[model samples]
Target: MNENKLKSLTEALTELASAERYEAELILKADPDTVIAQTVAAVRRSFALDIEKLLTEMGFLDPTTPEKCRQSAEAGT
Candidate 1:
């Protein structure tokens, strides 16, 4: 990805991860087996998937060659 797009994606993913972590912390205080806790966990996992999908859509992730994609992302290509 280009520099601008990478920056935007980084910002968005950071914000999303932060918000979800806060929410999970609050909900997880009750009990691990609780419905809310389970829901929060599911949401967290989904957020990761969403991030991956977003990256792929933005041309940052290549499912067929993940190592190359990781290298490109790390190198900020």
Candidate 2:
């Protein structure tokens, strides 16, 4: 992967860790169904997507491979 992409992935991972920590803290101090908790969950999900995109761009992840495998399996290939 390029330097910039690697940096981005690292930043995303850091942010995800922070969000997870905050989410855990919130869960311990407040109700899990609270709006803030839900928002943190959403933020975590967004960070996961960002990480996935970076990995895909770095050629570390093949997003289409799973779909292709599924299709081939259905076709008995």
Candidate 3:
């Protein structure tokens, strides 16, 4: 995904993590298992891109190996 889309997804995830209980309850009324699995997959994918963007913006990631990129971010944090 592009940086803008990645940032949008990350922001959505942050909002979902803090969603109101009533909204969460309504969402849970659906197929929770499938929803959770899909959410996890999306999160994992978005997390990688977000982390890469964050590291690059912070002048840490080499824009080559993502593993090294994450390590650099963590080291500073």
Q: Which stretches of candidate 2 lie above 4 Å from their native place? A: 31-50, 57-59, 66-77
**What would the per-residue lDDT of candidate 3 be over residues 1-77, giving only the tens digit for each residue?**
47876776567557545554444456568878767666656655666566567666655557667777678999995
TM-score of 3: 0.42
lDDT, candidate 3, at 13: 50
Candidate 1, residue 63: how far the Cα is off, in Å: 7.9
lDDT of 1 by residue, 2-67 (tens): 899989898988987898888777767767576584586688678877787878877887865657
Highest-scoring model, TM-score: 1
Q: For each candidate, what TM-score against the reference?
A: 0.55, 0.49, 0.42
Model 2 earns a TM-score of 0.49
In order of lDDT, best first, we have: 1, 2, 3
Candidate 1 structure, TM-score to reference: 0.55
Query: Candidate 2 — which pairs collide?
Result: none
lDDT agreement of model 3 with the native: 0.63
Off by over 4 Å in 1: 32-41, 62-77
Q: Across residues 1-77, which tens digit of lDDT does each residue of candidate 2 receive? A: 58987787788678767877776777667765666646766767766677677677777789896578779999999
Off by over 4 Å in 3: 1-30, 66-77
